[model samples]
Target: MNKLLLGIILGLLAGVVAAIAIPRHHDTASANATATPSGRPAAPHDQVVRLGKPETATQGSATLRPVGAATIEATAHDPHGGPDWAVRVYRGERVLTPRMRQQGTDGVIGHLKCAQLGRIHDGRFGWLDARGTFRPTPPQWGTSSVVCSTPNAAAPLIGTLSPITDPDASAARVRSTIVWGMAGPDARTVRIKVSNISATTQRATPHHAFLMALPARFGQHDVHVGVVYNNGHTASGPANTDRITLVARAPDPNGGLPYGLVTAPSIVPGGAARGETCLFGGGVRVVGDRAGAVDYRRDVLSELEVNGGGGCGSDAQALRKMTCLPGIASGTGDTASEGGDTGGTGRVARRTQRSRTTITMRCAPGVDRVTLQTPRDVRTLVLSPTAHAALAVYDGQFTTGGIRWTAHFQDGHTKSGAVPDVGF
Candidate 1:
């Protein structure tokens, strides 16, 4: 009975061992079944296969491929270094948004949408550089296909030239302010090309205007402007398209004196000339031709009357009264004239004059001071705050020959310009 029991126990142990060994052999076969015949591990079910390295797009170049009715694959490059790029899908110049990303080259852009892409059947792509600048690609028509486009190749349009008075007459130059009426869609910068002139072209970008100064020669000049886009495309106006003719006027032979004074007018004209003089310190004087004598006298009087109630008028009256003397003139023209009298023992002088009228006036608002530099001497005038005219009329005797003027503004800006050819 003991031998039979031991035999039963050994048989059960053998059955358990065989059952485990058979399953282990089948498990090995199952594991091996998953491998290739060469014994290499098989790839994962979710693994992505890479084709190869992508080609870099040139600056301003765009490549687009339609993936679906509303989606597209796109790529672009920056010629000016590796700039992060964005894609803009377009039908003509109209842009659409909601961009997407897909696996592509390092700088390649992908996945843009234009719901009307297939409906329009004609569309284009625009590549935006890292700098937030964009240039459109050429239009692509027809069904799904690879579309490649470049930046706009057309030149920018140049507009009319506006003449600007030369700031410095002594500099012997003229200025022309040009505007870009139609800068092409791709133009990033505008340039003015001035040639066939003796002056060196001076260019400045002030505000949004393009300003240029060229020497004021005696003849005609060839002038044109150009523009350059971010994509390195450039366009210029037709050569010699704009003609600028500068007429040189001879300097005042009389040295800015309209007429010679035989006898100086009274510092203060006592009777009828109450408001004839500019009470604001500078007085009017009549010297040579008197064609506008009555009108000029009337204007001066009107100015004094209108400004008389203001602080400007009070100040002028006070200045004239302080400088005026009885019978004795202190300065030429109306320099010493005023409405009120300076307390003195002598009687006031009265005189009748003709031929020329010289009036000294104040500057316009924003002018702090004005300096007139001439061949003979320099004259400086500190302007009043209330002055509001750009040009100041001075006594006819003030010489304007070879005059260069510098106007200092209240805001610390200075404008220096040549005196008008016609004496001021």
Candidate 2:
């Protein structure tokens, strides 16, 4: 079956979901299913495969309204590295989008772009305006770069651009929701803790959508997925806040590479379905488990995630080695609660040289405060109770000179060092 036709039980992440039916939470948590590839069958009418408001078949379920350009000024090189492309709205000035065409009953989703930019570089969805006025409404949910492209091909941008010839009409044909920031490499190392045992797999292509399985015994409350850093701090999403997806309810015997696995389209942790021009503050993440539950939450720790790279296929037997932690709680970072998508949680804002950049760090236990010093700014953040982390939103980027930082622990002990500029 088609992905849109497939029933998706989205947990409460806060957005308009559409499909054949809305899923319900159950104690079973699909106990009959596991994340491990089973080449399972299709889900029934009301099976709560993943956690969330199930996609519904009802018309008008998911709608798109174009939002304003996050930044008034923007610039980028042409794909061929030719002249800067036309489309001046990205240069500055508030430009209005074409009106969305109404189709009476069955009027649905569509794309939006600055009238001036036409079909080139700048375009976004989910900002409804009658004329040139920017009427501020609550942010639209599930906006991805489906339209925007890297060399014309990248992760799909669901609501941003158009396959439609007329902007007004595509807006009348909107169907489902969208998720963003899902850029990953050709291969990645995904680690999961199944009953306190740490297992790592580099078998995944890790793009668009994929699966990580845990044993059938695990529930939404028992899974966590995301990128685990070598420093022990993890950018993850917990199982609670409804971040579990079971294969039995939505099987994909031929998902990709390592067959039998399914792909859940655009998983926004905490259901960050809202829209923005450009977003920041979080990074991309993914994880694998056997229970058919993958936990991806908000970028709580504010770590940087690596993407735009991943392997082409997954090796089912590639689950190479296992490392056991003392206990579940023994792992640092992500304790419990909310989630994040590929990008950490932050409103859309274009990052400029002077724009504020968020700096975060995970400290050893007893660490109470962390401070950073850069040529342009100095920032300090106090760790929250039960949190071995610190966050500072300040100006300037980490440059070649590096930034000086210090981690202050409770015993008055201080560890200071210069964090080097980073790149992969």
Candidate 3:
């Protein structure tokens, strides 16, 4: 995916070339020209809305029962009754989904923030309804992670289990997160154990889900929440929580942030330069030692609304932030009013758009793939295993909007999110 951050870089690199096309008249038009290529009308913008009558999706009647004795509540919603859905823990009649508001020149504004717990297609499947007063306890454990394929029987079955980052929490200081999950029938309680050399245990039965926040110190692979169930007789089986490990808190300090939540050219290597940009292809090029730097090179061209207008390109040699290249390249913009293009000519300017833009990106850790959903096509980029942290070359475009991405973990789980791109 072309990083949404490319907006800043693309503006710097976009090479402005006045393309003149002489028109030729054709006597015939084919029947296929009259029909839209996709055979469907352009769909309306998809956004969460409140219907007079709410329709919640069961997804095969899937249900989540709180595990342990921690009194958990679950409710699902699908206001439009289709692809988009959000599940919340509230029992109130008012259902709060995502909404968009429009500004005068800023364009339509709407955003849905999600910590995805499951993967579906090219995106995350678990998006819960957001909007509520701050609550710091169970039963009212308003913030949660849920995953369900087919609704399971109320009890004795675990449906969703994933990590949690409290809503609007700061990354600079790691706050205590919930160790919450679903309980199956005969599932009585859950006990969480953290171990490095010695083991300390915490239970979720009598003690509430939200007590005092735990200290923010974590290493790796040293935690598990055991939710054992009583058998119909005596023989019992352990379910998902055994394999699902979680830390009650995240690590705090330099470069401290939740796993997979780091967006960069952050954390400059010792003696390396601060993040900066230059022109690559008629797009901007971000140059950084450790930050997420993306190079936008336009290989394709289309009817652009605005001609290229940017400053000079980068002067630094690759990876050599201190050394200088003899020549620093710069760009020139069109500044004449009596030239070929006029005020009214923009509506039907002669343009050539058969080319493509190739985007090279350096992504942060935990990002398996970067995708750009351009108006023309979707560009998928898979980072090389060893060089993912250093550098990787990929191809994509930096058109207006569409910068969605997915992060893959060692356990084969995926989390999806979007980054906003500036047009530069």
Best by TM-score: 3
User: What tens digits encode model 3's per-residue C-alpha lDDT throughout 50-141?
Assistant: 21122133222222233223222322222223222222222211122223213333221222111112111123233222111111112211
- Estimate, for each residue in 176-215, the C-alpha lDDT of model 1 and write its tens digit: 2122223334556665555643332222221112323223
Alpha-carbon RMSD, candidate 2: 24.5
Q: Arrange candidates by TM-score, descending.
A: 3, 2, 1
lDDT per residue, candidate 2, 1-424, as tens digits?
5654444424332235533255565356355433322233222211213222222221234444435543222222322221221222211122222344344433433333221211121143112111111112222233212122232232221111111101111011111111112212321334433345564332333232222322223433433345533344444443222322212111111121110111222234343342211111111222222122111221011011221111111211221111100000111121122111101111122242332233444444566776777665676766545324333433334444556777776788777766545530
Whole-model lDDT values for every prediction: 0.30, 0.28, 0.26
Q: What would you estimate as the lDDT of candidate 2? A: 0.28
lDDT of 2 at 28: 62
Candidate scoring better on lDDT of 2 and 3: 2
Model 2 error, position 351 (Å): 12
Better of 2 and 3 by TM-score: 3
Candidate 2 TM-score to native: 0.25
